[model samples]
Target chain A: MDISNLLKICIKALLNNKMRCFLTMLGIIIGVASVIAMLAIGNGSKQSIRAEIGSMGSNMIMISPGNGRFGGVRQSGSSMQTLKLSDYESIVRQASYIDKITPTVQSSGQAVKGAKNTPTSIYGVNEQYLDIRGYEIASGSCFTESDILHANKVCIVGQTVVNELFSDGTDPLGQTIRFGKIPMKIIGVLASKGYNSMGQDQDDLLIAPYTTVQKRVLAINYIQGITASALSEEYTDQAIDEITKILQTNHNIRIGQDNDFNVRSQQEMMETMSSVMDMLTVLLAAVAGISLIVGGIGIMNIMYVSVTERTREIGLRMSIGAKGRQILLQFLIESIIISVAGGLIGVVLGVAAAKIIALFGTPTAVSTFSIVLSFLVCVFTGVFFGWYPARKAAGLNPIDALRYE
Target chain B: MNEIIRLEQIKREFIVGEEVVRALRGVSFTITQGEFVTIMGTSGSGKSTLLNILGCLDVATSGEYYLDGVSVRQMSKNDRATLRNRKIGFIFQNYNLLPKTTSIENVELPLMYNRHVSHSERRERAIAALKEVGLGDRLTHRSNQLSGGQMQRVAIARALVNDPVIILADEATGNLDTRTSYEVLALFQRLHRDGRTILFVTHNPELASFSSRTITLRDGRITSDIRNDRIASAAEVLAAMPKEEEE
Candidate 1:
C-alpha cells in the first residue's frame, strides 16, 4: 500500500525483464529524440532566416513599379516603368522621414577586359545609395554628388566582377571598363557580400550614376526601383507611410484606385519570412508528434503483454494482501520509471543527434524549451499508455489469476 | 476458547455465459483458536474457493464470513485486503515467492503494507521468521536458488513474519517430493504446536492426517466433518508412511 513497496516491486519487475523493458523504452527514446531533433532543425532554420533578413539594412525600404496601363489589358509589374526621377527627387525633398533616396536603373551587358568578356548586370545609383543599402568601398573613393551632377561615367564594380576582370587581385581603381560600347572608369570596388536568401549574386554587380544610366546606357527617363533609408530605425514606418502618400498624390490616383507603386520595409519582409519559417517548424513538429504517438502505442502494447505475463505474480501479491490500488500503482510506477528513464536518455541522444546533424552542415539548434517539452511528453505517454494495463492487472480475479498457467 | 474464524452459510456461485456454476453451496464452519484444521477435497470440490474466501482473496457470492469478530463479507475491498494483511497469512503449492526477491525481502513484504511497523522491526521480524523456519542461513537466496523444500520453508517464513492469527495453506505440499512434503508438514505441525491457528487445504488423505481436525468436501458441499482427538505428529506420520523408491 505504501509507495516504497510499489517502487520496490516495480524495480524488481523491470530488473527481471531487463531486455524487454529496454526494448519497450526504445520506442519512447526514438520518439523523444526525433521530436527534439526535428524541432531543433526547424528552429535553427528560422534563426538563420532572421539573421539573413537582418543583414540587409533594417532601416531600408524598396519601392517597385506597378503594372502598366493599357486599353482593357493589364501588364505585369516587370513590364511597367511608372517610377520616375521626379518621384525620387520629390521623396528626398518633401518627405521629412526619408533620410536618403536613390533610383535604380538596371541592364545586363557584356563587360570587355583584355580578351575576356563576361555577361553581368550593370546597376545605376548615386553615392548615397551605397550607404543606404549597407555597402562599403574596399579600395578607391565612391563617386560623389559632383560626379552625378557632371553626368560622369565613373563606376564602382562588385568584388566578383573585379575578380573576374582582373584575375590577379590587382588594384583596379581608376581603370577603364567598357559596357556595350560605353567606356567607363572604375572609381571604387564594392566590399564583398555573400549570397542572399534568393541565391542572388550580390557581389557580381556593376554600379554607375543614375544620370549616366538614363542618358546613355538604358536611355529611358523612368527608373525601375527606388531605394531609400529611414532617418532612424523607429522612423521606418513613418518613412514608408510618407512615401506612399507622396507617390499616391504625385500619380494623381483617386481613393480605392490601384497605386502605381509598392513600398515595403525590411521589417515587413522579416516578419513575412518569420511566419513562413514558423509554419515550417510547426509542420516538422507535427510530423515528429506522430512518431511519439507510435511510441506511446508501443508502450501500451508492451504493458498489456507484461500484465498478462505477470498474471500469477499479480495474484500472488493479491493473496499476500496487496490491494487493487497497490497492484495498479506498482505497474504504473514500472512504466513511468521506464518512460522517464528513456526520456532522460533520449534527451542526451537528441542533443547529440542535433549536434551531429549540425556538424554534417545541417542547421540545427536544440532549445531548452523543446527538451522540457519532450521530457513532459514522455511522462504523459507513460501515464496514458500504462493506465489500461495497470487497471486490467488490478481488476484481475485473484483465484483465476493465481490459477493461470 | 475464542473462535478465530467463522463461516455462516457461505455460498459462492460463478456465472459462465448465462449458466450458473455453484462453486460453494451454503458451507458453514468455525475454526477455534490454535486449532490446526484441514479441508480435504478433489479439484472443483470448492475447497480452493473456500480457502480463497478464508484468505480474503475472494469474496463469496452470498455468505456471512467472520474472522476474529469482524464480518469479512461486509468489509470493503480495501478493508478486506487490510484484514488479509493483518489477520491471515497464505502459503501456496508453488511457493509463490517473488522470483526476483531474496528470502529476507520476501518475508518483509507483508509488513511493508503495515505502515505502523518500523523498518528495523520489520527486518528483525523477517530475520527471526527465517530463523524459525531454519532458513536463517539462506536469507539472501532468491526463490530459484533455493531447493523445492527450502523454497516452501521460505514461503512459510514469509507467511509467519506478520504473526497473523491464521495461516491459510492451499495445497502447500502439492508440488514437493514425498520427503520434502513431509518436512513441510512437520514444520506446519511445529507451528501449530506453538499455538498458531492453521487452515490447510489438501486433497491428499495422508497429508490430512497431520491436522487436528479435517473437513472433506464433495460436489461443492461438506461430505464429512471430523475431529481427530489423537492426531499424530507429522514426524510420526512421515516415519510410518511407506516411502516411494527413488527414480
Candidate 2:
C-alpha cells in the first residue's frame, strides 16, 4: 500500500486506543519539555555571563611592557619601557581585526580646583579611550587628536573627582585644574561607574591627551601602554595574534625569544566566569538525556504490549493480504506519530515553561538550536525504541496470530 | 465450472517438544467456482488445518496447491500474503470486528492492503458491501454498539468488501445463538446463490445440510465426500423457529 494510506491506517489504529497513546506520549512530552526548559535556563545564565563580560569590554586588549632581552642587555619590566609610539603606530598600520586603538600614559598627583584638592591618578588617553574601556562622558566631549598633537593641557574629570573638586555644586566644565605642577582645563565629566567587584571606586581618575602627559608631566616620548578592542568578541584571539605579530616584528624579537609586551584580553576572565555555568549546563543535559532514554523505554514497552494485544488483528490483516513489511510499518509509524506529536506539544510547552520561568525572573532564553536538537533527538529515539516491537509484529505467523486469543 | 482451488496430497506437521504431531497426513480436494462446500469434522480432525492451508495462512509441508490458476505450493510468504489478499476472504466465529472501529472501516480493512483501491473507491465499496449485508444505516456504528447478528453481518460485509475468489468461514456461526447462527448461515446461502465460492469449516454435523457439498474428515483423512442432491434453506429454518425467542 501507499505511504499515505498506511499512515492513515496507523493513525486510525492509534486513535482507536487514544488513552493508551496519550499515556505513552506523556513520557516523551515530559522528556522533551524538561530538556528544552532546562536548556533555556542554562543558556540564559551563559548569555547573562557573556553580557556581564561584554559590559567590561570583553574584547578589550591591554598591551603592557614585559621582560625583554635587547641584543646585549636584558631589561626586565619596569627598568625599561618596552612599548613605544613606533610599535603602536605599526600595530595601527597592520592590524585588521582591531576595531579601536588607544595609546595610554599615566601619572598621579594631587589635583586642585580652587579650594578642594584630591589625591587622584591622571590618565593620558585620546578619543578612543572611552570606547575601549567602556567609559561614557556625562557631559561635554573628549580631548581631540588635535589636543594630542598640540600637547594641549585639556582633561576630563571622573564623577568622584568632580564631586571632590566641586563640592559646592559648581560645574567644573571649562574650569582649570592642576595635576602636580601642570594646570589642565577640564573639558568633560566621566559617567559614574559606582564601585567594581573589588570594592574600588572607578570614578576617581582624570583623563588627558597621552602627548600632553608624555611631553609636559612625565617628559617622555615613549608610551606606557596601548589599549585596543577587537572588531567583535569572536575575533579577540585573532586580534591579539595580529597585535603580537606586529609588536614582535617592530621590536626585532627572534622566533624563540619572548616578546617585549603582553597582550591580555578580557576573554580570560570570561573563561573563569563560565565554569559554574558549564557545570549547570552539563547537569541539565545529563538529566534531560536520562529522561529521554526513559521515555524511549516507555515507548518500547508500550509498543511491545500493543503488538501482543493486536496479535489477532495482525493475523487478520495478514490473512487479508497485508505484507509483513506493512505490519511493521503500521506499528513503527504508530510509535513515531506518538513521539513526534509529543515532541511538538513538548516544544510548545517548553517554550511556554521558559516564558513562565522568565516571568519569575530567572532569565530563560529558548534558542532555535535547542528546539531543533530536541526534535531530532526525539525522532531518533522513536525510531530506535520502536524497532523491536514492530519487528515482532511483522514476524508473527499468520496461523498462530489468527488463532491468538 | 472453472476449478478455483486444486489441492494435491497436502500435508502439515508441527514439532511439539521432541515429538512431531502430524496435523494433516495426505489430503486432496478440488473446489470449483460458485461451490458451497462444507468441510466437517470433530475437534482435532485436521479440518482447521485444511482450512488454514486453503486460506494461505499456513503452508503445507508437502503439497501442490493452486488457487485461481496460480501455484501457491512454493510461493514465498510475501507472495502468498498478496495472493491471499487478492483471492481470499475470511469469516471467523467471533466476528473479529476490530473493537471501537466503525463498521465501514472494518469492511475497508481487506481493501486497505490493495494499493489499487483508492480512498474514495474504498469507501464506496465498503458502503456497498455493508449495504449488501443490510448494515447501510449502521456504517458508523462501532463493534460494541452492534448486536451479535448485526456484527456477523458486518463481518460478512468485511469478507465481501474485497470481492475475493473464495470466502472461507471457520466456525463462522459457532459463537452465536441458533437464531443468529441461522441468520448468518442464511446470509452465506444467499452469497452462495449469488455464485461466490465458499468453504465453510465447522464441527457441527447438522450445519453441513445448508451447503451443496460436504467433506468429512477423521484422523487427518477425508472419510466421506458427498454431493447433496437437495440443499436446505437456512432462512426457512430460521423462520420456522419459535417467534417468542427471537429477541
Give model 2's docking category: medium
Local distance difference test, per candidate? Answer: 0.88, 0.90
Task: Quickly count the clashes in candidate 2.
Answer: 0
Write model 1 residue lDDT over A1-405, tens digit each, in one string: 567766877888899989989998898898889889999998888787777777778788999898757676787876787888899888888999888789988899988777767788888898888888787888888888888887798899998888889996567897898888889999999999877766787898889998888788988989999999899788999999999999998999899999878899988888898899889888988888888888888888999999999899898878777889988988888889989998899899999999999999778989999999999999999999999999999999878898898
TM-scores vs. true structure, each candidate: 0.91, 0.80
Local accuracy of candidate 1 as per-residue lDDT tens digits, B90-183? 8989888888789998899889888888889999999999999999899899888999999999989989988998999989999998878888
* Candidate 1 structure lDDT: 0.88
iRMSD (1 decimal) for each model: 1.4, 0.8
- Model 2: per-residue Cα lDDT at residue A352: 96
Model 2, residue A214: what's the lDDT?
93
What DockQ does predicted model 2 obtain? 0.70
Error at A328, model 1, angstroms:
1.6
- How large an RMSD does model 2 have? 5.8
Itemize residue pairs with steric clashes in candidate 2: none
How does model 1 score by TM-score? Answer: 0.91
Alpha carbon deviation, residue A346, candidate 2 (Å) = 2.1
lDDT of 2 by residue, B62-94 (tens): 988999888898899999988888888899988
